[model samples]
Target chain A: MARVFMKGTEAIAEAAVRTGCRFFAGYPITPQNEIPEYFSRRLPEVGGVFVQGESEVASVSMVYGAASGGTRSMTSSSSPGISLKSEGISYCAAARIPMVYVNVSRGGPGVGSIQPAQMDYLQATKASGNGGFRMRVFAPASVQEAVDMTYKAFDVADQYRRPVLILIDGVVGTMMEPVELPPMKSDEEVAAMKEAKKAWTLTGHKLDYAHRAWIQPGNWSTKVMQSDSEEDAALYKSWQKEAEAEEFMLDDAEVVLTGYGISARIGKSAVKILRAEGIKAGLIRAKTVYPFPYEAYDHINYKKVKGILDIEMSIPALFVEDVQVAVKDRAPISTCLCSGGNIMTREAVLTAARKIMEAK
Target chain B: MELIYSRTKTIQEDKVSGFCPGCMHGTVMKLIGEVIDELGIIEKTACVLGIGCCGLQMDYMAYDNATAPHGRACAVATGLKRTNPDTLVFTYQGDGDLASIGLAETMSAANRGENITVIFINNGIYGMTGGQMAPTTLVGMKASTAPFGRNAKDHGYPMHMCEILNQLTAPAYLVRTSCNNPQNVMKTKNAIKKAFKNQLEGKGFSMVEIVTSCPTNWGLDPLKCLDYIEEKMLPEYPLGVIRDR
Candidate 1:
């Protein structure tokens, strides 16, 4: 298929449909509203269900319910809305329901602003909900990455039987870029997909006692709940093999700039400027924030590296906390950060990298 | 005497429900069981269970069910019904779960006319988290949160879900029934059956708000709870079909 110029939000909506998402329920929030708007127009053409949920709470819960019935379900929201959905997301995690949710994050400590920010990295990766269940969080830096990631999210969700989150900031979510959309699934393929879930989905089928996924907590004995937790813990542990990151220009670089989503995109531009000036600045863009891509830091030559510069669109730097963990104090950690809708500019990244050398 | 009807084949016999003794919640669950059985859709039914004591119905309601987090079962039912419209879907929620935290979800599901049934149990107080005042708690009702009785100035008047839902034109069937008395219980069973039948008929949204008893939470015994409903609850949430299209 030929690439088309489309807004990032529309590309995500169409990509979700192409990946066999037949049901979408979402509440409108800025920086992510285009997703539902596009779905309302596009889904009906494909025999898919589109619901503008009254609130994010209802939207995520709808996704949970639809997913339980073996539908390829999805919901999306920004920071404030995602907070409301944390309950249903945790429920999906507990029930081990497979679904995809997108967080086109905006500036927020409390409805802070509608502009882009990476303040939600910790929320997406770590404390997604009350329970310790982890999510497969994809932080796409570009519209192309958003399309590819959103398209592939469904399969990853089904493969792991968990909610996969596409954590893009307002920047990539609203940006227009050429993206090669994946082939759409035929109605027959959608039906077959539902049929494949008959074994575990909440169909009116006569289920035997061994049908684990269909049982709710009300029906679950304490023993069953404990065992399910243990099994899921093992499953989370097994995800390390699937953790991913993109390390750029890091063979012998002394300063590695680390960021994700739009910050990482700017960090790359900053790296290019640094390289042109004959300064060694590499970039490590975290594609999956949950897995942390800790191994990427291991690839860096410790002897050649002076410090890890974390660029974030946040106050006091949130993602830098994870960077601290990955590098483990092997090198000093510095941050170039802003907050309250202040985006991380490439010039800011270069300035921070230069300051790291000045302080050393 | 040969038993003309024993128990609904749809409900499990051996499973112990967590409802407190004398709670009308058991009666509501029985109605659900009987409705599913009489319709011959026991094997083709799925339930979304809301939080609170209402959730324990999944233990004995042998049909497949998903226990949603507090205030989310109706939204969950929307997903379930749309994903598999062939199966009859319903959500069982308590007053606190549905009318309080999940009011928007309940309304949206009804307004969208999603082909799912919602069985709302409006007891005057929150049963799961103790006797906290609920949105449907009467003005004069006493609860843990409303220590001095629900004063209208401080706490708003009880919300009539049936009346509010009736305002939404999308609803195929909306009714306020009860489990307080045998006659009312029978009416509730009939209302539930209608809601289920509507979904099977591919009609839009339907809900049965069954005014139920929370004896333990209401500071009333089993007997007083019935009296409380017949007196205080029924006057506010009158029993009868509000809408049946």
Candidate 2:
């Protein structure tokens, strides 16, 4: 119940097990190596599997195999390693296997420096691999959120039958902060949860209540027949509807500031500063990137919300694109980009939002 | 009738023979199938197919099979075995996939003593995208890509992957055999079965390199391909146990 001081990456690893994750396969990379190290020591204690793979390619595939086997599987890496994992992520998407991928963002074009960077935002939510599948990307601003998000990632991945990523930076991954662990489920609860997940998993064996739903390309007859039971199909459909973002403050605010992860923390500070100056600016934190939380924009009092400021730590303005897509036809949005780990400051975000408000 | 004895074929969907006629992929596939069946590991096994002709093996295998780009099968199999340690796992890879692009993965998995089997098919030339020079292509052997035969001076000698892998103390077994003739096929089948069964016995990394053929790439008929493997590749690659520790 009490919070303990933990590195952001370690907190995530601890929280994952607490949330019933039983399998972890990862390749060691800087900034987030602690995540795997923690698991290597902790996983076996709980009868979970922990593997330090030979490469990122295998790490993700290992996750894919374990996840398909009805294990709560996860893998984490930095930029270059994440790039190598793209292939398996695509396969996981194609197979609709549920898993989690932690990308502790690092500076990179090709094994570039390993400080920190938000350059992988687009790669995480968009080009994770081939296919139109959306990976749920969580941008946690603090070690607390980092731990909390890791626990949520499993449920979200299972809910969507796709990969969910906790996109942290080198700073967040290495930073030490107080984090309260999620309540650990009892063995019975853990077993029940795993059993529930088996309903859709391709585990080696099955019970009488569970039937197989095979997927094959170019099988017209099979496609027409659709073996998915009505109940399972409906469960899949409900997940699509629950996809949304967390809109914070912004009821009567004139200019809504949009942010996520580390940038959101800065935006919160900026909002306080803006309010101190009598500027009616609030914040909307994007909790989930894919699914983009378009509903957050709909809930905004559009008449008072004249503009949106997107503060992100990225080079190509990746997350801002999603913000624009989310706010389309609802409100105009502007952006402040911080490339290669150059974190966005509170003043810069406030200034950008003020500029948008003034122009509007 | 059964070669290696697997329970089911996970790659049965694709009908096209990506391998040359009489190439060892089909034989090796059946052998792997036999092993899977005999061991009763098919339901829980995960197979990784390396790029080149053997890569498409996943298309016909009926288990939970996956394909890795060239030379990456060992790397992929390492992941599969590590995460799903309870399940039996192996990689199906050709020479180019194992010795060239994926050399690091193969060597590293073996060195780490990862509990998995590697079914290495050494057909001497790149077979999937047409014949090309390969790490295991014999000296004085002509390939379409090699044109004037592989030269030790220019391309280095054909790597003895089995011999090289045997040097790693971590590996439990390393056997090299041929799939060119019936006798060799039987030996190859036995080698594959033993390699996989080693893991089932809790033995560490085991590899079986089957000296195979690529009739299409070797510019020979199916029978000639077998002849070439038996006469040329076997002598150079050698056919025997290099390690059993």
Candidate 3:
């Protein structure tokens, strides 16, 4: 594939159109608004439905209804807008509706700022809804990955019968990088995707004349209905194992650093700097945050590894908690956090790792 | 023996409704379903249900359906109809869902004359959320939230949604009928059929505000519920065609 330079938002929108997405509904918000604007002009040319909804709530529901009708649907929003769509996302999860959601996070506790920050780590990974239903989250670091993650999000959503989110921070969302998009599927492939909906859609119940009678259930019954089969339960159980991450320079190390999203990109530079100082340090970057990839910790020898540094750009040390939980009995963990728009640099992470190593 | 019943002609049987027993929602659903069947547009029809007892209409009917959030059926229907212009779109809402929380959405859609049908069911109380006072709850009517009755000094009088809707020139057909008695049931059916017919004729936004009963929430039996809707609610919200533009 010939790689071409593109922004993260553009890649996601283009990849969506490539991967059977025929309906795009969204409201304009910072970091993610570019996606809707890009699709608004391009989607119509391909005979796709693109609607700029009146509100985030309506935008998410538009995707919900369109997906319910057996069309591939998607929507995008930033922090505050994503907060507004939580109710709709919950409903889609409860109904096991297959849809894609792209969240280009910016600094926020409330109307915080539009600059790059990892403030939404907790919101994107946990308590996404009233129910503790887990939404599959993909944290892409670069523009190319953002586009590739969106194209793959639909496949994962369909395969699991659940909602998948592309959780990108403002740094990746706005930055332009090299990307090579695969050729869009032919008409036959698009038709096959629609035809494939029969395996799990509730479009209609085929009945005969002899079975025409109806028995009405109570209102409470609708709440208790079990739409997922035994096979679905088994597939859901294996999702955690299939999730992935990226590892660099972990084989011979005395200290390890863990991060994700834009922070991981910074972590790579820090790893090189620490290696130049003749310190044994490595980096473990997570690609899938929801699955948490617990097995990655087993590769590091806790006895030899003195400590771990978890760096993020959020208040209250959100991502570090995950790192602590993953390496519970193994080593001491420290956090590098920023509340507003201050992103941690390569020098900052390396300095934090050096402090941990010197303390040991 | 004519034996002329064919599965109510419109609704699918297995879905089995979730509305309370003796509730008027069932009658309203059947009427809408029959009208869809009569027009031969079931496949191309899409219904939007708001959050209320009446919104359970989606469970009873088999057309392309969507259950919208509280006060959002009209808004969602706007999107549904605009995207699939060939599909027949309608929004089903109750007094609370349509008149109170969703008032903005309902009025705006009506004002836009967005070619869609809205089956506004005025049951006087929020039945789904435990009988809270709705915007259309009659003054002096006691609900869970309005225990001392909806006071003119405090809560004000019940809103006449049909009259409010009639003020807009966009709606080509707007009628207020009841399902209180056999005679009124026939009138409600005719009103609904006409709403669908208006769409077939490309006549813009049509709505039929059906005066119905919520027996469980009203602290009345099925028969008394019917009597209350006919006597108390109807006198204040005079039953008639508010608009036939």
Interface DockQ of each model: 0.62, 0.24, 0.30
For model 3, residues B118-199, the per-residue Cα lDDT tens digits are 8988888999889989888888889998899899889887888888888888878888999999999989999999998887
| Local distance difference test, each candidate | 0.86, 0.76, 0.79
As for candidate 1, its clashing pairs are none
Per-residue lDDT of candidate 1, residues A1-360 (tens digit): 997999988899999999899899998889888999999998899888888778888889889988998989999999999999998888888878999999998888789799988788789999888878898999999888998999889999998889999999888999899988889888898889888887778887553333423545323478877788888888888887778888999998899999888898899998889989888889898998977788898988889888899888988689988888889989988888888787777778888898876674
Please, what are the lDDT tens digits per residue for candidate 1 over residues B36-78? 7778886688888888888877666778888887888878888
- TM-score of the A chain in candidate 2: the value is 0.85
Q: What is the lDDT of candidate 2?
A: 0.76
- Of the candidates numbered 1 and 3, which has the greater lDDT value? 1
lDDT of 2 by residue, A1-360 (tens): 997999999899999999988889888888788989999999999888887777887677668766765678889999999999988787776656788989998877788778878888788776787654566677787899888888888988887677787888887888899888999967687677767865444433321212332312112245443553343355544555556555666787888888777777788888888888888888888766654676777767888887888877776777787777777768777788777656677778877878877783
Interface RMSD of each: 2.2, 5.2, 5.9
RMSD of 2: 4.6
Query: By how many angstroms RMSD does model 1 differ from the true structure?
Result: 2.1
